[model samples]
Target chain A: MGMKLDEALVRARRALDKPAEFGPDLNVSEFAVVTGGNELALSRGRDRLSLVGVDLSDENRAGSYYQVDESVVGISAKMPGLTVLPFEHAIEEGIIENYVWELVPPDLDKYTALNAIYGRRGYVVVAERKRKIREPVQACLFMSSPGGIQVPHNVIIAEEGSELSVYTGCTIMPEVVGLHVGVTEIYVKHGAKVNFVMIHAWNEDAHVRPRTAVLVEEGGTYVEHYINMAPVASLQARPRVTLAGREAKAHLSSVIVAKGRSLMDFGGLIRLEGEETRGEIVSRVIAKDFARTTSRLRLEANGIGCRGHTECNGLMLSKRAQILTIPELLSSVSDAELTHEAAVGKLKEEEIYYLTARGIKRKEAISMLVRGFMNVRIEGLPSKLRRQIDLAIAMAAAGL
Target chain B: MRMTALYVRNLFVRSSGEKMILKNVSLELYSGERVLLLGPNGSGKSSLIQTIMGNPKYEVVSGEIYLNSERITDLPTEDRVSRGLGVIFQMSPVIRGISLRDLLVKVSKRSGVSLEDVRAVADELNATHLLDRSLNQGFSGGEMKKAELLLLFAQNPKIALIDEIDSGVDVDSLNSVGKVFQRLFSDENRTLLIVTHTGHIARYVGVNTAYVMINGRIVCKGDPKRILETIFKEGFNKCLECVGVGDEAR
Candidate 1:
């Protein structure tokens, strides 16, 4: 190996020895999770997990799969052409020999701490060129034990001309006090397409931070839809996508609900680095019951003929709730076009009256409006996944 | 004598800024009676209808409004709607992100009407094509009036307030709207209060009485045909002389 694993680990430790500061109000050094006396029963945890489309079972392992609970418990690939395994096993077998620690370096204190102390981490999915995976590769990273931290490193690669879909749900048992720091890296090669859907169903006492980055090559398309409608103590994530070759495209969307004094800071950035690259980012946030949420989207166009647009809208459902939206656009080349729009406000009274005047109750009217505000139509989603997302949105609206 | 359907007695209303908008307005309509409220611009015709519909913006400083002999001046707009009061505004606000189909479904569920009936009404208004679109979003004046009429038809309230439904509407839409009203008012238990400036709708629906309003006060009441013809040909100036108001009143 050009770089010894032990030496690379040491370097990562040195680089990320201290907790990184994100902003004035969101410094990680002051972040901590309080545990004990908050663990949920197994059945209850499984019930909560099912909300995100993860059904817990011990039957025969089917399709491409990875199920984690404190550690990687199950890994399989029923598909003949796909390769799936635990991270350490993949490393030992040389399947991950060339890519380990290369995409996500120990560049931040959170990552450094996780690398030094993580108990279970592994799962890499590779779809070779010309292969089209009809069934999605599903993974569930669940927290059943209280106060136990879960640090998972996931790497997904779609080789040239391949098409694949991935569905991942990360959830914690209700009242479980823990922290989850996951690092995900995805690569879409020439003429390949990758569709990724991630749902986070954390409890009110859980703190989550996910570091994700994607690179799309020539004629490649990457689409990502993320949802976090469950209550959480605090969440901070900023995922990025880079279009690095001609005609690369990326579309990123998120639907978030912050309730019950939760603090959420979420953002997405798309960088256009190649000629004729295009990108779009859209986010919808609903904050209620004293929850505080901040959503930001940044689009950067640096190449000729590049185009991008970013939209961030927030709805405040309570007087004590707060929402902050920041949409930014930057263009370096005169031919590159970039635009952004951001809005944050409570529901319009006129809309409420319009419904109530039709004899609908005031509460039902508000719920309908809130549901409509969060209903974002993402193109290219499978019918089943779309139905699951619709259910989650309806549940969130009802809870609010 | 016919039973009273809606009775507005000594009503005093104010705008949001506390300025009097409707002063000492009183009117009565019996069941199955169609009344035409005629006035020029800023004459408080809309304010009277809005106040009777329990709009909080038009504060009722005094007096009372009763729907079917049930006092509703203090009731909320929704409660008033539940008590058989429905209105079509002159200019309804656009409800963003709400589709016409969704609104109609909710109205159907609340008003005890079936979805099929709502669709039938929408089809009659030539608005079935607009059911999936956002409510009142980018709709022309005539379309807006038609949409409102669709909602009113679904609501099927005991007392219907049609505010300027004929204005800004095409001849065909006006005729269609008039036909629907004629069918609805054929029942002696239903009441109608139509507010208009042009009185062009008089050519379609039979109006039992016409009350001419000027400067927030009802100045004259007479037969609908005579009052509408006088106001249409000779202008409101001729009606002003019939009331004999002083400068302070103007």
Candidate 2:
């Protein structure tokens, strides 16, 4: 093992010793990793990976993968496949070896603990300069083994003037109990644009913690859309993005549904650190069936001519369900502008009555409103991916 | 056999915990009959129609409402709608995130009407451009009235309760709306109870009977032309005098 790996492992152990506090109510002390899907291991052990058996097909099957338990069973890539490789390979090839810990260090307890004991932690995708990859790169991470802990690290880099889009879905089998801690880092170079879409569909007992960070250089653009449409035991994630170059821009949005007694704490932070930088964060949350969700958004403008805005909206579906929204904006320079808006409430009775008066049942009317509330249009996404998102949203609303 | 299209007897209603808004209101509309209800603001004109449509906010202290000779006093709003009761609200609430097209689709499906018919209705109302827009959000007064009319057209109810549909509409839209109302009233099988303060709509569509409402009670009922002329020339006080309740009418 390299000296850096040895040092990272030691740091990881020390960080795990002092676990970071997620929230006052969530408990992650007794969680442990389990192993069960040997069939997945045998099938994935082959050299070539096919995503056919997992129900992912053409058009919807852009750069797909099936990660069961601690192993990646099937994996494939299309147009951008030539530049995609395991993170470990990237490290060995010295592509990002020195900058591995720069974005997300082992100082954070979750990252430390994940780096210490994770079984598989390597996937990186790169888009070369000035190349526009029209197709989305799709990936799926599934947890089938009960009580298993799955930790994966992903890195994506967009070179100068390049454009790329990625779609990632993380799910679990029925009735499975597991914890997923994923660390993702993205880098957008000068004049480049990157759009990232992540969909999380977990079982009722699955716990999820995702750590993500993005850095956009001068004149770069970054757009991210995160959606969680399934019921989970508990989920807590706070992603951050920094516009470190002049004239860079970023937009982050999330749509979440909390149901079945699940507890979710989701947040996003953006730091405008360069001149003429801009950022915005928008989150929409729906809570039902005794679920509790807290959404937090913060934007800080520290450089001259920087502008940022944050918006958070939530809907409560039941008396037992709860939703909390907190939006904050901070400006350190006189020329910087920051603003925020937040609202949490139940569907309007008048709106519901309007539909009911048209002969729609109250329940169906509420569902339609909820679906519409959760439908936050994202610009620049491919039509195919937008359709997939629409389907997922419909399924989620029907379940509610 | 003849059947009563709508019948309300001794209808008393209160809003939330407030005092009574509608007191001992009685109304009867025979099948194929058209009636005009005139009242000043806050005279329970909206409450009466909304109560008939089963708005739960208005507590029906003691009342009975029947549609097609079937009692619906205890039915829900949706059930009442299923029984062919439709209303055009005076001030329609904006429903965020739901497009007019989606709402019309749902309404058409539930009413057993085709999407093409709904579109045609919208086209007639000059609301085809609003199909993809959010329901009632940021719409002008004339546009909102047109949208409500389009929904009512799609509902194709046996009896339609139109509350001040002529208010706040432009002259051109008023003419168009009047033309539509004329066509709707041309169907001898359809019934209408239109609530208007200005009685401007009476000029466009024929009204068979007119009722003057004051202080939550109907003070007078007579020929639409005579009563409208009395209310227009000498105001509602004259109509109150005609009912021998001039002192009590507000």
| Residue B69 displacement (Å), model 1 | 0.4
Q: Per-prediction TM-score, please? A: 0.86, 0.89
The lDDT per prediction is 0.78, 0.79
TM-score of 2: 0.89
DockQ of each: 0.47, 0.63
RMSD to true structure for each model, in Å: 4.5, 4.1
> In candidate 2 chain B, what residue range of length 10 has the lowest lDDT sum?
B241-250
Which candidate number has the best TM-score? Answer: 2
* Model 2 misplaced regions, further than 4 Å: A1-13, A24-55, A80-82, A97-99, A116-122, A275-277, B1-3, B179-185, B244-250
Which run of 10 residues does model 2 chain A get worst, by summed lDDT? A45-54
True C-alpha contacts between chains kept, each model in order? 0.57, 0.76
Predicted structure 1, TM vs. truth? 0.86
Per-residue lDDT of A246-323 in model 1, one digit per residue for the tens?
Answer: 999999989999988888889899999999999999899988898998887888888799999888999887899999
What is the lDDT for A107 in model 2?
51
